[model samples]
Target chain A: MFECLFEQASLLKKICEAIKELTDQACFEVSGTGISLQAMDSSHVSLVSFLLRNEHFSQFRCDRNLTLGLNLKMITKILKTAGNEDRVTLRAEDDGDHLVMVIESKTGNKISSYEVKMLDIDQQAFGVNETDYKASTKMSSEEFQRICHDLLVVGDTVSIEMTKDGITFSVSGTETSGCITCRQSGTVDDESVGTEITLQEPMNLSFALKFLNLFTKATPLSNSVSIEMSADQPLCIHYDIGDMGNIRYFLAPKIDDEEGAGAAGAPAAAPTEAAGGDDE
Target chain B: MGIKHLMQVILENAPDAVVENPVPSYFGRVIGIDASMALYQFLIAVRVEGQQLTNDKGEVTSHLMGMFTRTTKMMAAGLRPVYVFDGRPPEAKQNELARRHEVREDAKEKEAEAKEAGDQAEMERFSRRQVRVNQQHCDEAKRLLTLMGIPYIEAPGEAEAQCAALCRAGKIWATGSEDMDSLCFGSPILLRNLTFSEARKLPIREVHLDQVIAGLGLTMPQFVDFCILCGCDYCGTIKGIGEKNALKLIKRWGTIEQALEHLDKTKFPLPESFNYQQARALFQQPEVLDPARVDLRWGQPDEEGLVQFLVGEKQFAEDRVRATTARLRASKQTATQSRLEQFMGPPAIMTSCSAPPGPWPMVQGPIVLTPSPFPPLRQQAGAAAAEKGNKKARTSAKGAKGAAKATATKPAAKKR
Candidate 1:
C-alpha cells in the first residue's frame, strides 16, 4: 500500500505537465523515501527522470516498493480539473488495479474523489550514472526558454558553445540568422530572467530546437536550470522542482546538420573553473 | 494534405469515442455550429437537377433556405444552436485554399465541356463541384439568421477553432461540424451529421474528446502530432504516410520525429523543410477571442424583417414563410413551458375529485367542467373534436365523484 498527500495540487500538476509531453504512460516507483518516476520517451532520443522526496508530502507511507503504472495524460487531465489550491491525496494498494485520488478545497468543504485505473507495467528500475561533464552552464530557465522560442523561427537547430567568454546560442536558417549570448554573472539575483554560467572547458554542441523547446516545458517546475554537456553525449538539463526533488532531461544532440555549419561563427571555446552554482 | 481520411482513421481506431445518440437527447443543450460548413453542405445537398437554388433575381438562395429549415427544425427539437462564422483565415491556409480554388476551377471547365456535350450526369457532378460560397452568400446568411433570432459570431480565425475554444471555456456544450478536426482543436464534444436528414439509415454520431484521449492513449501533444502526420490543413504530409502508418508510428514512437527516423527514408521521404512543429503549435494553441466577452442571447424573432427579406426580397413563397414562422413560435412556447416544468417541479394540478367545499359550493348533480382554455385549434372545428371534448368533460365530472368517495372512505377505513 502507498499513500501520499500534496498540500497544493499545483505541484503535482506541474510534475505531470512536465512528463506527459514525453510519455503517455509512466511507471511511478513508490518507496519509503518518496515517489520517483524514470522513463524514456518512446523515441528513446530523450529520457526524463523525476524524483519527489517522501518528506515533501504532508503524509507519506509505503509498505513495500510498489510500481504503479499510470497514464500521465489521464493524470494531467484529472489534474486540470483541480484548482491550484486544492489539496490532493493519492492512495493505492499493492498490486491494486486502480489508484484512488481525492481533491479537497483548502477549507475541506468541497471534495472530489477520482479512481483512475492503473496499468500492469513491469517493474523497471533504471538510473543514469553521474557524469563529470566537460562543460556546464547555470542560467535562468526563462532566458533559456526565450532563447529557444526566438531561435525557433530562425532555424530548427540551436548550437551552444560554452567558453570563458560566456555561453552563446546561435541559429541560422535559409532566410534568417540570429544569436543570443549570456555572459556569466558573478552574483545571484532575481529568480527569473537571471543569467549565470559555469564552464570548465570549451565545448561546442548542437541540439534540435524542437527538443530544446520541449525541455522548456519544465520551466514551470523551476526558475533556474543547469545545463551539462560533454563531447558527444546527450545534454542534461536539470531543474530543481522545489524542496521535493529534481527533474532532469537528457536530450541527444543533433549529430550532423547543415544548419550547424551555416549558423553564425561558432564562438571559440574558453576554459575556466566550474561556476559555484553547480551541484556540490 | 489535410490528412486524407484522418476522420476515418479516428473512427476506426477510437470506435469508443464515437457514440450514436438520439437527436432529442441533446434537447436544451447549446451547440456551436460552423456556419460556413453548414452553408457548404447545403449548397451541395439541396440541389435540383444540375443547377443551384436561386431567387428570382438569380442570386443564390440555397444558404438562406437551408439555414431557415435547419434552424427552425433544431429550435423545434429544443436544441439551441449558435452559429460561428470564419473570419480572416490564417496565412498557413493559403495552400489549402488555393488547392480548393484549383479544384473548383477545373470543375468549372469540365462543367462547360459537359454542358456543350449534353452529358447531363457529368454536368451535374461537375456543377456540384463548382459550387462556392461567396461574400454575398455570407451576408444573406447572416441577415437571415439575425431576422430569425439565432445567435452567430464571426470568429477571428478558423470557425472550428472558435467553436472548440467556446467548448473549452464552457461557453457552449458541444460543437456541430462534419469534420472531425474539431477533435484536433480540442473540442469537448463534436456532433456529426447534425444537419443530415433523419430519414437516412445512418444515425447521428458524437465523439467525446476525453474518450478520444483515453482511447488513443496519447497525450494531447502526441495526438496533435498524430493528426499532423496523417495530414492537416496547415501543412503537407510526409509522402506515403497515411492514417494507419501515422497511427502506428505515433503510437510506437510517440512523435513524428522519432517515427520518421524509424521509417525507411527510401520508402517515405520526409518533405523538405517540413514545418511540423509550427503546425503542431497552431493546433496546440489556436487564436480565439476571450470566452467571457462573447454574449449569446436568443431573442424574439423579427417576423416583419424575416418576411421582408425572405418573401419580399428573396421571392420565397409567402405562405411557406408564414407557416414556418408560426411553427417556430409554437415550438418556442412549448419549449419554454417544458423548461419551466423541468426546473420548478411539474405545475400543481387541481384535484377536482376532492369535496372539501372550500373554494366552490357543492353541486348536487354532475358538475360540468368549463371547456379547456387550450385546445387543438383545428380539432375544435370538427365533430370528432366535440365528441372527444364531451367525453373528456364527462370523465372529469365522474372523476370528481370518484375522488370524493376515495377521500371519504380513507378516514373510515382508518377508524375501523
Candidate 2:
C-alpha cells in the first residue's frame, strides 16, 4: 500500500496542471525517493519531466517501488475537487487497479473521496544526459509567458536570439511583427521584474510558439524560470516547484525548410550573416 | 474530410468506444434538433415522381409535410423537440459552403441531362443532391413548428453548435444531429439518427462524451486531435495517414505532431499551410453564445395562421392540412392525459358533462333535470367512448318523448 498527504492542496494541483498540458496519460513512477514522471509528448516536439520528493509531503509512506499508469485528465479532475485550504490524501494498494483520493475540509469534519481507475500504460523511458548548453537566461516566468503569448498572434515560429547584450523573442507575419527583448540588469525597482543572462557565444534558433506557450503551464509552479539553449539543440525550460521538486521541459527546434527568417519575424537584431540562408 | 473517418478511427483504435444500438429514454425530456439538416433530409427523401413536392404556387411543401408528421410523432412519443435553425455561416466554413454549392450545381446539370436522356433513376439520384435548405425553407419550417406548438431557436451560427451548447448548459437532455461533430463541440450527450423511422428495430445510438473518453483512454483534447488527424473540414490532413494509421499513431505518440514525427514522412507527407492549431481552437472553444437567455416557449398553435400560410399561400392540400390540425388536437389531449397520469394519478371516470342544455330540453320532457350518465356533451368528442354512449342515450330519449304523451294526463298525480 502507498499513502501520502499534503497540508496544502495547491501543490498537487500545480503538478497536475503542468503535466496535463503536455500529455493526457502518463506513467508516474513512485519510489521511496518521491514521485517522478519523464515522457515525451505524443508529437515528439516537446518533453516534460516532473519530480516531487517524498520529504516534501506532510506524510509519505511506501512499501515498495511501483509504477502507476494514470490518465492525467482523470486525476486532474479529481484534484479539481480539492479546495485551496483543504488537506488532500492520496492512497492506493500495492496491487490495486484504482487510486483513491480523499479531500478534507479545513475543519477535518467534511471529506470527499474519489476513486479513479488506473491504466497499464506501456511506457518506454527516454532518458537525457547533461548537455553543455551554450547560453542560459534567468527571467521572470510571467514575462516569458507574456512574450510567448503575444508573439503567437504574429506568427507560428519564434526566433530566440541570445547575445552578450540580452535575449530576444521575435516573430513576424505578413501584416504584423512582435518582439520582446530582455537584458540582464544589476538592479531593478521591482524585485520580480528582472532578467539575468549569461552567454558563452551568440546562438540562434526557431521553435514553434505554441509549444513555448504550453511550457508556460509550469508558470504557476514557479515565479521565475531558467532557460538554457545550445545551437541545433533542444531548448530547456526549468521550473523549481518550491520544496516539492522541479519540472523541466525540453522543446526541439524547427529545422531546415528555409523559411526560418520570414517565419521568425525579421530577426531585426540578429547579425547580418544569420539572414543569408533566406536570401538564397 | 468528414467525421465518418473519425468514427472509423474510433472503431479501429478502441473497438468498444461507441456502444451502438441502444434505446434512448426520451420520456419527459427535451431534445435539441438541427432543424436545417432535418429539412434537407426530408426534402431529399420525401420526393414524389422524382420531382420535388411543390404547391400551386410552385412553393416547396415537402419540409412542411415531413416536419408536421415528425414533430407529431415526437410529441406522441413523449419527446419535446426544440428545432434550432442555422444563422450566418462562419468564415471558416465558406470553402465548404462553396464546395457544396458547386456539387449542387453539378447535380442540377446532371438532373437536366438525365431528364433529356429519359433516365429516371439517374434523374432521381441527381435531384436528391439538388435539395437545398434556403432562407425561405428555414422560415417556412419555423412557421410550421410554431403552428405545431413546437419551440425553435434561431442560432447565430451552426445549428448543431447551438444545439450542443444547449445540451451542455442542461437546457436540453441531448442534441439530435446526424453527424458526430456535436461530440467535438462538447455536447454531454448526443443522439444520432433521431430523424430515422422509429419502426426500425435497431435502437438509436446515444453517445455520452465522457464514456467515449474513458473507452478510448484519451482526454477530450486528444480525441479532438484524433478527429483532426483523421481529417476535418477546417484543415487539411497529411496524405496516406488514414483512419487506422491516424489512430495508431495518436495512441503511440499522444498528439498529431508526435504522430507525424513517428510516421513515415515519405509515405505520409504533411500538407503545406496545414493549420491544425486553428481547427483545434475551433473545436476546443467554438463560437457558441450563451443559450440560457433564449426564451424557450411552447405556445398554442395558431390554427388560423397555419391554414392561411400553408393552404392559402403555399397551396397545401386543404383537407390534409385540416386533418393534421385535428390530429394535433387529439394528440395534445392524449398527451395531457398521460402527463396527468404521470404526475398525479390516472383520471377518474366521470359521468358529468360541461355542455350547457340546449333550448329543446324542456320540450323533450324533464330529461335535463336528471344528470346524464354518459360523459360526452359535444360533437367535439370524436374518440371519447363516453360520446358514443351519449349518442345512444340521445337516441333513446326520442322514444321517451313519445311515451310522455300517455303519461301527460297523469302528470299532476305523479308530481310527488
> Per-residue lDDT for B79-160 in model 1, tens only?
7788887778887778779989999999999999998999999989998888787867777777777677677877778888
Clashing pairs in 2: A42-B253, A42-B258, A43-B257, A43-B258, A172-A265
Q: RMSD in Å for candidate 1, one decimal?
A: 32.2
Q: Each model's fnat?
A: 0.00, 0.00
Which lDDT tens digits does candidate 1 get at residues A1-280?
A: 6788999999999889888887787777554445666666543456677777554566776654455678889999998889999999999875566889999998999999999997644322222435678898888888888899999999876889998778899887756888999887754654445556666679987776867788889999888899898875678898988866788887766554232233213211110121111110
Among all windows of ten consecutive residues in candidate 2 chain A, which has the lowest summed lDDT?
A: A271-280
Looking at model 1, give its docking quality level: incorrect
* C-alpha root-mean-square deviation, candidate 2: 35.2
Model 1 misplacement above 4 A: A1-280, B1-3, B198-202, B336-416
Model 1 misses residue A53 by how many Å?
53
Model 2: per-residue Cα lDDT at residue B82: 85
Per-residue accuracy of model 2 over B1-416 as CA lDDT, tens digit each:
24646555555555544645433335445788888888987887666786778987787888877887777777665466788877777666666678889999999999999999999999899988878888778777766776666667777667778888888788898988877787887888877777765555556667778767777778888888888877776777788877666667778889887876677878767788578888787777766657767545444455677788778877877787777776654434322111212211221211101112122111222323323211111111222213233232212222322322221210110010
